[model samples]
Target chain A: MKSLIIGIVAGILCTFSFIPQVAKIIRTKHTKDLSLITFSALSLGVFLWLIYGLMIKEFPVIAANAVTLILSLTIVMMKIKHG
Target chain B: MKSLIIGIVAGILCTFSFIPQVAKIIRTKHTKDLSLITFSALSLGVFLWLIYGLMIKEFPVIAANAVTLILSLTIVMMKIKHG
Candidate 1:
């Protein structure tokens, strides 16, 4: 039970870390300063995590990485759109 | 052995995902678009992961999260310096 709670907290903190950045990007419509390489790498990394999670059958890992993939990919798309 | 390899691969992908961004930041020295909140949250999250890794006595988890914390914290510092 404790371990599960810890996992959830860690997952939430890490995955949701991008929320503020996403909000800022949407509000400002500026992404020239954001590195495409960084966001792209992040999306790829999260995608790999999603796969790993699936392989291990870990729901928290899967859910967190899935949401992270969406958020990171959104940043990548916005960078492309505003680039 | 397969599970260990998976963990290593996932850890590498997720933690090293910041390398490109760090390199770009060093070269271009632009960080105005990167959100303070995002990096701060990332640092906190990674720190939590480190603690969790320690608690669980997981070497790979500890090492990966430690490296990630350093990289993410570097970005945070750079953002401050260039903000």
Candidate 2:
């Protein structure tokens, strides 16, 4: 139970890290300073985490990475379009 | 062997995700669009990951999150100073 709670808290904290960038990009419609390379690497990392979660059959990892992947991918796409 | 390799790869990938943002902030000397809230959350997340790694006795997680924390913290500081 403690580990689960810890995992959830960690998940929420880490996942929310990208929100500001996302919100900024959405509002400004600009990502000139953001890099494609970085976002690409991040998206790939999130994908791997998703796979790792599946391999380990861990629901928290799976769910967190899934949402993170979507959000990261969205930022990547926006950066590409607007950068 | 594969799991170890996979873990290392995932660690590197995820760790590198923030590099671009860090580089950009350093280069541009601007972070007006970046949010303090997001960076704080991210730094905290990295710290938690470091603690989790310590608790689990996982070197990979420890090493990765340590580097990530340093990099992310650098950006946060820069953003605060320059934003």
Candidate 3:
């Protein structure tokens, strides 16, 4: 139970941290200073994590990475579109 | 062994994904567009993961979260210093 609570808290923190970034981008529509390499690499990393989660059949990991992957990919797409 | 490899790969991906962001910041010294709330939250999240890893006595989790905490914290510090 303690571990589960900890996991939930940790998951929320890491997963939603990207929310503000996404919101900022959407509101500002300015990704000029954002690095393409960073977002691209992050997206790739998230993709791997998603796969790992799937391999291990971990629902939380899968869900977290799935969301993160989308957000990171959005950033990457925004970087391309806006840059 | 397979799970270990998967964990290693996942750790490498997620932990080091911040590198390009850090490098970009160092090179550009422009974080006006970056969101402070995001980094602050991320740092907190990584810190939790570090603690949870210690609690569980997971070496890989500890090491990975430790490195990620440092990088995320560095980003937060850089945001403050450069902002």
Query: Which candidate should be chosen as best, given DockQ against the real structure?
Result: 3
- How would the docking of model 1 be graded? medium
Give lDDT tens digits, candidate 3, residues A1-83: 68667868988899999899999999999887777887787788788888888888999999999998898898889889988
Q: In order, what lDDT does every prediction score?
A: 0.87, 0.82, 0.86
Better of 1 and 3 by TM-score: 3
**Compared to the true structure, candidate 1 yields what TM-score?**
0.91
Candidate 2 scores an fnat of 0.47
What are the per-residue Cα lDDT tens digits for candidate 3 across B1-83? 67657667867877888888899899899887788999899899889888888888889889999999998998899999988
The interface RMSD value for candidate 1 stands at: 1.8
Highest TM-score: which candidate?
A: 3
After superposition, candidate 1 runs with Cα above 4 Å error: A1-4, B1-6
TM-score of each: 0.91, 0.89, 0.93
lDDT of 2 by residue, B1-83 (tens): 56556556777998988888888888888777666777789899888888887877888878988999998899889877987
Kindly list the per-residue Cα lDDT of model 1 for residues B1-83, writing each as its tens digit: 66556667767877888988888899999998999999898898888888888888889889989999999999999999999
Clash pairs, candidate 2, are none
